[model samples]
Target: MNHHAPLSPAAELHANVSVPFERAFAMPKSVYTSPEFLALEQSHVFAQDWLCAGRAESLPDPGDYLTMEIAGEPVVVLRDRDGAIRAMSNVCRHRMSTLLQGRGKVRAITCPYHAWTYNLDGSLRGAPAMTLNEGFCKEALGLPAIRCAVWQGWIMVTLNPEAPAPAEALAEVTDLIAPFDMTGYRETFRESFRWATNWKVLAENFMESYHLPMCHAGTIGGASKLEEMVCPTGGAGFNYHWILKNDSVPLALAHPSNTTLEGDDRRKTWLLAIYPSLLITLTPGYFWYLSLTPDGPGHVQVLFGGGMSEDWLADPAAEAHLASVRALLDDVNVEDKGCTEKVYRGLCSGLAQPGPLSHLERPNFEFAQYLARRIPA
Candidate 1:
């Protein structure tokens, strides 16, 4: 755990990940800057884990769908005719073309190449002009199915067919977040952006609020008091903490219907990181999340969404409130982008060695531990 330790693959990893929370150091810069390590994570970590897509509520109707890339594998996530959500390979069975591009609705997923069509359930329905090929059996050809499920209203797809259900791994906190009514929050805004940093960097940043008072001093961070924060113990798949806010701030105010929380919960903001890359922040009046995907060791794509609670959504000032919230969040994001990108540049400088973790950075310690176990030895 020494900061000045000589750098090697194993030594670098050990330097960052092998230490107690109080004496912990940041993961080596190589962990974020090495393409070799990114490839390893793609295979052993992302490919084997259940990754969150957007909310299932986004696709309320049958045949509605969204597509995302998981560990370099393109996947189609959709609700079929029977209202069952399914994840299947986006690669068409014929000619290997991407069947769906992005989020949309369709009676059937039809390939832009060669006109191969598939039913909502991923069954091959037609293969035009394939009669000439006697070996081509339409019934036998279909989009390969991937493991998928809707848990707590979020759509999650795993590239590994044998992975356990996402809900099962997340059970430790199911009751903990029940008060937030995760399913009742409808997405009112969405933004997709890329950060010039590793996905883990962004994930670690979002999991803890240690830098809030400084990084976001002018916005929501102004209300964050470090002394009042409560960090939950790490579990198999998640880490969370609650930061109590000043009651006078408009941003810290509670929703009218948020009666489930009492005392400190009334003014507390909850931040939860669900395993590898799903980060959620819940307040009494609103909730937002970041679902991150890595494009490379130094590039991360983010799917960001936020929404109001049922109480606020019913208010006459909902739109105005939402606009203000969005603006505040945008400012916070800009600040974060600058901070993380700069850190990435520093890490790439070769002089950036592992640094000691703060008491507030316990979540980062847990995250490093999680990554260490899954990364190739």
Candidate 2:
């Protein structure tokens, strides 16, 4: 079942559990700027969670693979000669070097360090400088491999030794979309942008809807009403759900309805930020999944992908919807970047105190709780 455990006593205590209408949160500035805390988070949060790395559809054929980084570990996902998708370290096990620099077809992963080669399935295929049988057994010298699994065309990966199997951990991300039958949808647009700010700042910014009226004023605010927007929270923390005004999508699309959407159409559009890093949006004409990857404490790369029918993939849809999404994103990003930098600087002013959280800011409160749980004790 898709669910979230209740907040712990300490978590509830740190963030006042009573207020239902306040926007203030008391997250420590250190969590945003401390060098020690960021390193601990890499092991506790990024390396341990089941993350959506890339789409399985992108690597559907044999020898096809994408060079990517999981948490901070360089890795590759490839369809082997036998047509099975496998996850393996993109680093050569012999001398510990990068195998592939970028995404492409490869009969074998050859290391630039010493010309060591590995099959996509991670078998030690060739080593020019060393003897095979006289040295390490090819069977025993395969590249290190990690577990990966696909659901609804999304490829999720993990580096944790004890992380639940991909299929089991992702059952929740899948069940949430069961009503939409996403297999029929195909990726139409994919774009990524690197921002000069902390990734957690972006996550905290996206976990709620309070900024829509102010930050998103030019785009979504220009086209619709935020006051009537219905946002409810779910997921591990307080993720959001809402239907906007004037959301007119085709009935044949993912959300099929003959009725035209007016003010506050509850089923018109759905926006959710899944725990940790995934941002998912389901609209009348399309659906998009975004992953927020932390390059370092002060840097992040936002990966965005759009989905639609075979027909829409060939052409664009209503300009207003796409424009609103992009503009709202830009506005929110600008607002968030300012705070991230401010917090990055503020943490140094000796105001780094653990403050209480208001319940209306439940998502941010839970975010602090999540960081607390993930950081090593």
Off by over 4 Å in 1: 1-11, 248-252
- Alpha-carbon runs more than 4 Å astray in model 2: 1-24, 170-173, 230-233, 248-267, 309-360
TM-score of 1: 0.95
Highest-TM-score candidate = 1
What's the TM-score of each model vs. the native? Answer: 0.95, 0.78
What TM-score does structure 2 among the candidates reach?
0.78
lDDT of 1 by residue, 1-377 (tens): 68986565544675577667878888877788888888888888889998989887788899999889998889999999999999999998877888898788999988998889999988999888888998998888988888888888889889887887877788876878776767777788887899999898899899788888888887777687877777767797889888877764454557656667787777777898998899988877788899999998889999999887777788888888888888888989999998899888888895667778888888988888888777745
Give the per-residue Cα lDDT of candidate 1 at 180: 70
Model 2 agreement with the true structure over 271-353: per-residue lDDT tens digits: 66656787766654566777888877777888777665333344455444455555555565566666556655555577566
RMSD of 2: 6.6
